[model samples]
Target: MALKLYNTLTRRKEEFRPVNPPQVKFYVCGPTVYDYIHLGNARVFIVFDVIRRYLQHRGYRVMLVQNYTDIDDKMIQRAAEQGFTVPELAERFIDAYEADVRALKVKPADIQPRATGHIPQIIALIGRLVEKRAAYPSGGDVYFDTAGYENYGALSHQKREELLAGARVDPGEKKRNPLDFVLWKQKKPGEPAWDSPWGAGRPGWHIECSAMAMHYLSETIDLHAGGADLIFPHHENEIAQSTAATGSPFARYWLHAGYLNIDDAKMSKSLGNVLTVRELVKEHHPLDLRFLILSAHYRSPLNFNSELVEASRSGRQRLQEMVDNLNRALPGAGAASAAAESRLQAALEQARFRFTEAMDDDFNTAGAVAVLFELGRDCNIYLKEGYPYQRGLLEKAIGFYREANKILDILEMENPGELEHDIREAIARREKARCRKDWTEADRIRDALLARGVILEDTPYGTRWKKKA
Candidate 1:
């Protein structure tokens, strides 16, 4: 089946056809670079990472661009509170963001432009908007003329009255329409200033993305993605100014990941429930967090808690254990009967089909992951049957896992030597206890291993250990 993704712009699932086939221009809104990235932010990044990976896997050459907002109001305020220059603060947090996402195994974007680095592009875009009469200057600030853009609320799908109900002019502002948003902010005392036609000031929040995306990619890109929270004024403003300036669609397809809640409640500063990716990695494996995020549909709200994370960790370990068992059994196995090999091959083929079907339907990672577990279960049954394992069949099973891992990126095993040694020692002790008829000792060892996320299954071949999922 061809790939289909839910486009927020059209409010429906549409078959993905880039403006140029086999060359996708994907853009995702990156962090503000003022503070450590939290789990909510991590969800957006990981979701897009998987999308990019899947696109590549499907034979699309994707040039992904994710920008850094290095000079926003939040960055300026945070730099002052932390006693650092704005650039210093941006550098610090940008490094932190990269480190955190790398730990989660998210691939880096093809181009990561910073707002401060693209000042010329931003100024030139604003100049084009001014020339087109899409924006106007007031009190040394440049604000987009929402009235000039007839389809102001097209992206957000809100009526003008609905947008106007919530819009308001801030104190000391000179916008003709409350719905109009700033393109450039005039210089404030002691703040970072850049030379632009609209006096000496910095780019506003929305314009930075429009300028950077168009400069790096094109005026009309394939996909634009961010969290669902950005569907409002941020993305809405981006659509208006970008289309008005270029006289073309900003992005053909829009994707938004759902909100990530903390224990069934929204994460907020007043609640103090925000969890940073850096801190969570110290407590749990980074892959576990990535797995948890993908366990639910990308557009479905996912709840993060200790229970869910532990479950995800166990699930990830279970998949890894299947691969490890295949490795261990492959080295010491004879050829299997033709019937056995045929059965396993059929199962593998079915799994491949199902996985592709799921992923093609709007990148349904949850369904795709279910296919992995189902395949793992089939492999476990085949191993337990004690048939002479064929080298080709075992290798094929491992190959399927490797193919899935390329897109999911959740099956990486760390320190396999050390872990294997420990499991071997524990199993040996249990075998000795069983031989001596020390049932209590054997049971205790079994329970202890189970507690440590290992499961022992006594087969006719011998006592075998797999991870507890």
Candidate 2:
């Protein structure tokens, strides 16, 4: 089945047809580098990373670009509060963002453009908008003329009157309409400044993305994605200014990942419940967090709590144990009957079909993950001691898991050699005790292994072990 992605622009799922076949220009909005990234931010990063991976898996060469907003009001304020320069603050948090996402196993973007690094591109785009009269200058600042953009509310699907109900002019702003957004802010004392036709100032928050995406990709890119929060003023402004300037669509498809909540509540500073990836990883495994995030549909709101994370940890360990069992059994596997091979092959094919079907339906990762669990269960059932093991068929199962991991990135692919020798010896001794009906000795060995964070499970095949989650 062809991949179908839900387009936020049209509020419907559509077949994914890139502007240029086999070459997808994908752009995701990155974080404002003023503080540590929270779980909500991590969700956007991970969700897009998987989407990019799946696109490549489907034979598209995706050039993914995620930009860093290094010079924004938040960065300036944070730098002042911390007694550091804006550049210093940006450097610190950009490093933090990278480290946090890397721990979650997200692949690095092909292009990580910083807004400050592309000042010229930003100025050039603003110049085009001014030339087209889509924007106007006021008090040494430049603002996009929202009134001039006929399709202002198209992307967000809000009527002009509905938007106006919540819009208000900020103090000291000079624009024709309340909805007019700043394109360039006049430089304030002690703030970072760049030279532009409007004067010495920095690019506004929304314009930075429009400038960087168009400059790095093209006038019209295949996809643009971010958190659902950005669907409004942020992404809406992008569409208005970009399309008005170029007379072309800004992005062919818009995808927004759902909001991530903390324990059924919105993450908020007032509530003091905001959980950063940096802090969360100190206690929970990063991969477990990734697993929990993927357990839900990408566009569905996800609730994060300790209980859910623990469940994900246990689930992840089950998959790892299945892989380990296959690896350990592969070395001593005997030939299988034709019937056995055929049965396993059919199961594997069914798993492949189901997994692809899930992913194709708007990247339903939760459904895809269910397919993984099903495959794991099938593997465990087939690995029973009474069943003959075919080395080639077992290897094929391992390959399927590795292939899935390329997209999900949830499993730890440790080889048999990586399993601790002492643990294996202990399991061996426990099995011997079991064979001799030495219940006390077996219990003692099991307790000892459990103390060391090694969990042993007695399967129909034999003894299987995995590290405690």
Candidate 3:
């Protein structure tokens, strides 16, 4: 079956076809770079990161572009409050965002364009809109004319009339229509400003994405993604500004990850419940958070609570233990058993099929995770009862685990050679106890291993050890 993804633009699952075959141009809206990235931002990055990995696994050369809003109202306010230059503040947070997401195993995008660096592109795009009469300058500020675009609210599925009903021009704003958004804002004292045709002002929040995305990718691209919160004003305005200027589709497929709520409440600063990656990683493993995020469908609301994270921690531990046990069983295993080999191969194929099927259906990460557990169970059963010590069979199981981990990115095992001398000696002592049928000594060694967060399981071939979470 062909790979399919749900496009928020069409509001349905469609077969994924890159504008250029075997090559995908993907864009995701990055953080504003004013402060540390919180859990909500992590979900969008992680989801797209896995999507990019899966696409690559399917043989697509994906060129991913994620842009940072280095200059914005929040950046200006925060920088001033912290007594640092705007550029300095942006640099600090951008570095922190990279480190935090890297801890989550999110690969760096092929192009990470900062809005401030692409001033020429932003100015040129705005100039095109102005020349086309899609935008107008009033008192040194430029604003996109929502009425100029026929399908202004198409991306958000809102009717122009309904949007106009709820829209209100904020104080000190000069726009013909309430739905009109700013393309560029005039300079204010003590704010960062750049020289543009309209005046000395910086690009607005919406225009920065259009400029950077179009510059790195193209006027028309394959996929554009971000958190669901961006759908309305941020992404909606992007569609208007970009498509109006280019006279082409801004993005063919639009993907948005769901919100990350804290204890069933919206994560907010006033609530004192906003959790950042820097804070969470100190206590919980980053993979645990990744597992928890994947536990729900990408488009579904995920509740962040201590209990759920604990569950993810335990689940990841179980997967790790299974991998360790299967690896340990490889040492003393005999030559291939055709029957066992056949069974393992069939199980691996089935798991792989299910995983692909899940991922194909709109990148169903939760369903993909279920396939991992199923593969783990198959390996465990084979190691316990279906084993005549088939080395090939164990290897196949290990290979499956490794391949799945490419997308899941949850299993990280310490090298057995890196195990301390004392731990290796303990493993050997346990083996000797079992050889002598000394049940008391064997149990004592097992308890000692448990104290070190290690678990030992007896298989048909031998006893294997794994570290607990």
Candidate 2 collision pairs: none
Off by over 4 Å in 1: 335-342, 413-415, 418-458, 463-469
Spell out the clash pairs found in candidate 1: none
lDDT of 2: 0.92
* Root mean square deviation (Cα) for candidate 1: 2.8
What tens-digit string does per-residue lDDT give for candidate 2 at 1-469? 7899999999999999999999999999999999999999999999999999999999999999999999988899999999999999999999999999999999999999999999999999999999899999999899999998889999899998899999976876688899999999999999999988988999999998999999889999999999999999899999999999999999999999999999899999999999999999999999999999999999999999999999999998888888888888887787654655466678899999999999999999999999989988889877874255887789889989989999999988768464589878998999999999999999999999999998788976677776666
Candidate 3 wrong stretches, greater than 4 Å: 337-342, 413-418, 430-463
Q: Residue 97 lDDT in model 3?
A: 97
lDDT of 1 by residue, 1-469 (tens): 7899999999999999999989999999999999999999999999999999999999999999999999989999999999999999999999999999999999999999999999999999999999999999999999999998999899889988899998875887789899999999999999999998879999999999999899989999999999999999899999999999999999999999999999999999999999999899999999899999998999999999999999998888888887888877877777655665466688899999999999999999999999999989989888877467787788888888888889999986332443568777989999999999999999999999899998788877788776554
Residue 336's lDDT within candidate 2 is 52
